[model samples]
Target: MAITCGLVVANIYYNQPLLAEIGRTFRLSESEVSLVATITQVGYTLGLLFVVPLGDKRERKSLILVLILAAALCMAGAASAPSFVILAAASLCIGIFSAVPQLLMPMAASLASDEERGRVVGKVMSGLLIGILLSRTISGYVGAHFGWRTMFWAGAAVMVLLTGILAQMLPRNQPNFQGSYGGLLKSLVTLTRDLPVLRRSALVGTCMFAGFSAFWTTLVFFLESDTYRYGSDVAGLFGLIGATGAFAASFAGKSADRKGPDFGINLGILLFVGAYVLLAFGGYYLVGLVVSVVILDVGQQMTHISNQARIFSLLPEARSRLNTVYMTAAFLGASLGSLSGAWAWTHFHWPGVCGVGLAFGGMAYLLNRFYGRTASVIAPAL
Candidate 1:
């Protein structure tokens, strides 16, 4: 499950360093290459809207398998795109189908004891975090040697194998409701009505990820600029630093399962704040780059797994729909991050990107404060 999710989620980020390579191949500008991120986020947001709810209504195993197959097809299309337009369209498809792992995650969660679920999830999520960070490195090496298209091909092959593994290993899932699909859409609106549960989970998850999205969106710009003077390969290696956080995920997971999310979140905040401090230094000193990645990634992944662990406890039966809302908010932050990161890169450089991340962190902190006062959060029943 970890390998499957890690490889699939990696698709979202693999193009970070390759943006420069893509610019040269397509005779595009820096801003244009940045659109690749925008397009994918937009598509993923749509996927969160339409596909994630399937876990609540449809059978999860089949839904996951179908989505994986579709993702494979999308990767193949991305690999074979004849032009940037086609490539962008293909990326959209990849984003749309990448919701597969989201489906699989809660399915895995449901099977485990609550006491151990966070640990199990954290271990699996470590794979995902590593995958997200490493894909950039892998793509850099692969794109430099074989061309950017080769990364998509590699992604496609991974999806093919994951599909088979999932099909064989996952439990059979029966439908949850035979109701109209329209009702599913209707419930989405209800979920957004700021129920105490959604308030605590969706809002917190979204706000936290906003900072995460902000930092990651312009990471390539940071590396490629005069600040770092890094090529794709070096930018990619920066991804390895993030793997440190991945190694720590199971620890965070065990902590979450034992102590609950509050402790994990506080730790996450301190770590993220430290990450920005490190990056602020990185803006001046080149060596700070390495430390920043490890700190930031560890913080982000810890908060993420912890947040999901808390939210899932609220609505066990509706895990998929809950994830849909959580992730939708998460992607909204990402979309804002991508667009803002591009504008910041065009205008204020590394400080601007850091500023974006810090602002989101501030917003998340405010919300966290509000959450602290709420009856739900004061003594969260979960």
Candidate 2:
């Protein structure tokens, strides 16, 4: 499941480091090119709303297989695009179908015992996180060497192979939801309304992800700017630097299991604030940027892992719907972050990007500290 999640979710991030290359290919302005990344996130959010809830109503393995296959086809389309518009359209479709990991995650949660749930989700998430980080690294090198289209071609082939392997290894999970698709989606709203923890968790996760997204979305542009005059490969190398800290994901889950999700979450948020402080002041230096990437990634993993552990404990039967609500809000933040990062880069450069990241971190800290306390009364400590 971990490998599957990693490979599947990597599709959403392959465009970040290659954004500059894609823009060059199309002769687009920075902000205009950024719509590619933003539109992809918007597509993912749509899928979370329309597709992921079916995890509770359909056979999870089959749903996952179909999504993966569809994503593979979309990747092929992206690779063969004749125009910028076609590439962007393919990216949207790829994002929509690439939501397979969300389905697999809830399935992992459902299969695990209460005592093992956090650790299990964490393990799967580790793969997902590593995939996200490494995809950029690989795509960067590939995009630089073979062209950006090669990365998408490679992604399509990998997904097609994964589908065959998973079909044999994945366990068959019976549908737990007994209702119309409309009813399943309606329950998502009801779940959000009734659960304070769900609302608080979603908000905190959204802010954290927004900050994370802001940095990544503009990183290539920052590296390519006059201060550095670097290329896409260097931008991709940061993904490897960030992946070095992704192992913290499993530690975060263990911490959540042992000390409660709130402890891990607080620690993560503090690290996030500190990372931005470094980026805001020291980002002009390559060494400072490298160190800050490690801190930022570790903080992101900790907060994300703890947040998932907290919400997954809310209702076992509704785990898919809970995830749908949380991830939809989070990806919406991602879309907003990408759009804003491009605008900030256009207007204010690196300082503007750092300012946006810090603002997001501050919002996450305040929301988690004040609102999380109230939600804790009703939420399980796990």
Candidate 3:
């Protein structure tokens, strides 16, 4: 399931390293090409709001397979797109269907015992994070050697293969919610209203992801600029360095299991701030960039894993809905970050991008530090 999660989630990120090539192909600017990444996250937010809730109302394995197949079709569209508009449209569709990992996470949570849930989620999340980081490496090399469109075709083929393998390997999970889809979505609001931690966690998640997205969305442009005079292939190698965060995801899960999740969350947010500080001051040097990306990615996975560990423990029956609320907010932040990162790069360059990351990280720190200070919200039994 973890491997499958990584493969499907990777489709959304494959375009990041290829943004420069795509812009060259379409004769567009950095800000204009950024719409591809932004719209993709917008589609993902929509899927998190609408599609992920269905996980509770539908058979889990079948839902994952269907979404994977849909993602494969969308990737094919992306590959064949002749114009920028068509490519953006296909990217939107790809984001919408690429909500497969959200479904898979809840399935893994449901199957595991409470005692081991954090470890289990960490293991699966390691794969997802690896997929996200490695997708850049793979796509960067593929886009440089072949054309950018070849990466999309490769993504499609991988999804098709994942669908076939998961069908035979995954266990069939019965639906927990018997109500209509409309009712299921409505309960998301109810869940938000009732769970204070979910709301706070969602907010923190939003800021953290916004910072994370801002860095990644603008990185290739920075690399391609006169300062580095590098190509996409070299830019992609950073993902390999960032893969150290995958280990952080696992370690964070264990930390949350031993210490409280609050400890992990705060530590993660601090790492986020420190990473931006390094990037702001040291980003001109390749070693500084390398070190900052490692810090950034590790912080991202730590916060993400810790947040999921806390949220999944909230309500056994509403894991999907809880994830829906949280992930929807997170992806929405990502969309905003991508848009802002592009605009900042156009207006103020690398320092501006670093400023954006700092602002978001600081906001997240404030929220995490102050929330539940007076009183603690209790998590329900699994």
Best by lDDT: 3
For candidate 2, lDDT tens digit of each residue in 1-382? 9999889989999999999999999999888888888988888998998999999999988999999999999999999999999999999999999998889889999989888888999999999999999999998999999999999999999999999999999999987889999899888878887788888889998998899999999999999999899888889999999996569989998898999999988999899889989998888898899999999999988999999999999888889989999999899889888988888899999989989999998999898888745543433211
Instruction: Name the TM-score of candidate 2.
Output: 0.97
Overall local distance difference test of candidate 1: 0.79
**Which tens-of-lDDT digit does each residue in 64-114 have in candidate 1?**
889889989998998898899999999898899887668767877888897
Alpha-carbon runs more than 4 Å astray in model 3: 372-382
**TM-score ranking, high to low:** 3, 2, 1
Q: Of models 1 and 2, which has the larger lDDT?
A: 2
Tens digits of per-residue lDDT, candidate 3, 237-326, equal: 888899999999889988888897888899999998999999999999989999999999999899999999999998999999999999
RMSD of each: 2.6, 2.2, 1.7
As a whole number from 0 to 100, the lDDT of residue 149 in candidate 2 is 95
User: Between prediction 1 and prediction 2, which has the larger TM-score?
Assistant: 2
Give the lowest summed-lDDT range of ten residues in model 1.
Answer: 373-382
Question: What TM-score does structure 3 among the candidates reach?
Answer: 0.98
- List where candidate 1 sits over 4 angstroms from the true fold: 375-382
Cα lDDT for residue 278, candidate 1: 74
Ranking by lDDT: 3, 2, 1
Candidate 2, residue 44: the lDDT equals 90
